[model samples]
Target: MSTLTERIDIQVKSRHELDEQLEAAVRELQEAALHVRARGILITRRLPGRYTAELSDHVPFGMTRELLR
Candidate 1:
């Protein structure tokens, strides 16, 4: 029970940090007033401690894609 509580706390903290970072990105882009969803980042683990991130057209604009995950 204690372990689960600790894990939840850690996840909560991490999520908050990620939210802040995303907010900063949106603010820096200067598109705060407008909502645009067309592209996304797909990160995949390549090697140990290394990963590859690519700009994917997964964000539904007028089409859809199969979610494998």
Candidate 2:
């Protein structure tokens, strides 16, 4: 009976430790996800401006060609 009780206690402690580690891992994953989402948002916000700049740079060339013709 004593040995059974001792085994049960050890199992409980191990399970508790595993639960804590799992919680910590979940928190870390959430933080990483937030950082990734923020970076994605930043990139998305900049895309339109970058595309407009590229288009604007080509406009002068087109205008110059029209003038030459």
Considering only N, C-alpha and C atoms within 3 Å, which residue pairs clash in candidate 2? none
For model 2, the local distance difference test gives 0.25
Number of colliding residue pairs in model 2: 0
- Find the 10 residues in a row with the least total lDDT in model 2: 2-11
Q: What TM-score should be assigned to candidate 2?
A: 0.33
Candidate 2 residues 1-69, lDDT tens each?
211110011112355664564345334434443433321100111221121011112232222111111
Evaluate model 1: give its TM-score.
Answer: 0.30
TM-score for each of the candidates? 0.30, 0.33
lDDT of 1 by residue, 1-69 (tens): 211110011111355664564345434322311234554444343433333333345533333222222
Error of 2 at 14 (Å): 1.1
